[model samples]
Target chain A: DQQVKQNSPSLSVQEGRISILNCDYTNSMFDYFLWYKKYPAEGPTFLISISSIKDKNEDGRFTVFLNKSAKHLSLHIVPSQPGDSAVYFCAASTPGYALNFGKGTSLLVTP
Target chain B: DTAVSQTPKYLVTQMGNDKSIKCEQNLGHDTMYWYKQDSKKFLKIMFSYNNKELIINETVPNRFSPKSPDKAHLNLHINSLELGDSAVYFCASSQDPSGRVGDTQYFGPGTRLTVL
Candidate 1:
């Protein structure tokens, strides 16, 4: 069973605009969420993370919002640049060690 | 310098063959993990080790085994490989379990295994 799900397989946005990617989870035990950006043939790089204690976390042009009640989280990138085009993965983990990841969403930023 | 590194970036083999993938981490973390990414790009944890001790072993098949000789190394050995085992395997390391102050995982570039 897939505990974490990314409904959208792909997304496209214009440069200098905003891009939003959504993720949902069925496991209530997950308290920490993270987003990673991956380029072709490269490893997934950590982007931003949010703890269950907080509803939102921001880093530069990236922002992540979490809604514990709905078990939903979203990653937003404002003024998206061409360099932001890549596959974004959403991962969640409990207090334990293992992490559950979504299927990932491919983002394309048009110049 | 690579924080996490995996050898044999690409491996292609026939079914029923046995192979191994080696991983090393230089971050001096106490915990390490193995994750598999299928064709759909869904990453799943297969095993976890803390201080060279096995901690979490997911529902992986018995054909797959993880060996950690030291805290800095974790290697995966697959026996009688099948076509379904083709995927990209990644190695990660963290400070420790329990989600303490420092538990952020660093991932490797990943090894793509293709079983024919």
Candidate 2:
């Protein structure tokens, strides 16, 4: 069973615009949520993360919001650049357990 | 310098063959993990080693084995490769996983293995 799910398989946005990626999880035990960006052949790189204690966290152009009641989270990239085009994965983990990753969403930023 | 590095970026072998992928991390982290990404782009953890000791072992097939010679290196050895073994394997490391601090796992470039 998939505990974490990225409903959207792909997304497209114009350059300098906002791009929003959504994620949902079933396991309520997950307290840590994170996002990773991946290129065509490279490994997934950590982007942003949000703890269950907080509702939101931001890093530069990236922002992540978490809604514990809804078991939902989102990653927002403002002013999306061409370099931001890549697959984004949503992962969640309990305190010490292995992370459960979503299928990933492929985002394309058009120039 | 690569913080985490893996050997044999791409491996193509026939069925029933045995192959091993080597991974090394220079960050001096005590925890290392191996994750596999299937064709559908689903990433799943296969094994984790902390201080050269097994911490988490997922319900992966018995054909797959993970070895950690030291805290700095973790290797994956597969016996009797099958078509289902074709996927991208990623190695990651973190400072600690005691849950005291939210750990960030740094990943390697990845190794693409193809079983023909």
Candidate 3:
């Protein structure tokens, strides 16, 4: 069963615009959420994360918003650059547990 | 410097063959994990080890086994590899001795396994 889901398989955005990717989960026990960015032929790398206690967390141009009541979270990239084009994965887990990852969404930032 | 490294970036073999993928991390982390990205692009955790001790084992087949000789290395050995076992395998590490779930994990460039 897929506990984490990223319904959108792909998204396209213009450079310098906003790019938003959404994810949902069925497991309520997951208290930690993370976003990972991946490129072709490379492994996924950590991007940003948010805890259940906080509703939002931001780092540079990347911001993650979590809504526990809805079991939904989102990653927003402001002023999206061409270099930001990559596949993004959403993962969730509780303390001491292995992470559950989504299928991932591919983002294309066009100049 | 590479924080995590995997040997044999690509492996192509016939079904029923046995194969092994070696992984190493120089980050001085306490925990290591193995994840498989299947054809559907789902990155699923297969196993985890902490300080050379097994901590988690998902519903992976018995043909797959993870061996951690030290805190810095985790290797996967597959016996009687099947066609469905073909996928990109990733090795990851984190410094979470306390088992914090959100600790950032560093991943190695994946090893793509092909079973014909």
Better of 2 and 3 by lDDT: 3
Better of 1 and 3 by lDDT: 3
lDDT of 2 by residue, B6-115 (tens): 98999999999999999999999999999999998899999999999999989989899999999999999999999999999999998866222456888999999999
**Among these predicted structures, which one has the highest DockQ?**
2
RMSD vs true structure, all candidates? 1.2, 1.3, 1.3
lDDT of each: 0.92, 0.92, 0.93
lDDT of 1 by residue, B1-116 (tens): 99999999999999999999999999999999999999888999999999999999998999999999999999999999999999999998989563333567888999999999
Candidate 2: fnat, from 0 to 1?
0.66
Error of 1 at B89 (Å): 0.6
lDDT at residue B85 of model 2 (Cα atoms): 96
**In each prediction, how many residue pairs overlap at the backbone (N, C-alpha, C within less than 3 A)?**
0, 0, 0
- Runs of candidate 1 with Cα error greater than 4 angstroms are B98-102
Question: lDDT per residue, candidate 3, A1-111, as tens digits?
Answer: 999999999999999999999999999999889999999999899998888999999999999999999999999999899999999999998877888899999999999
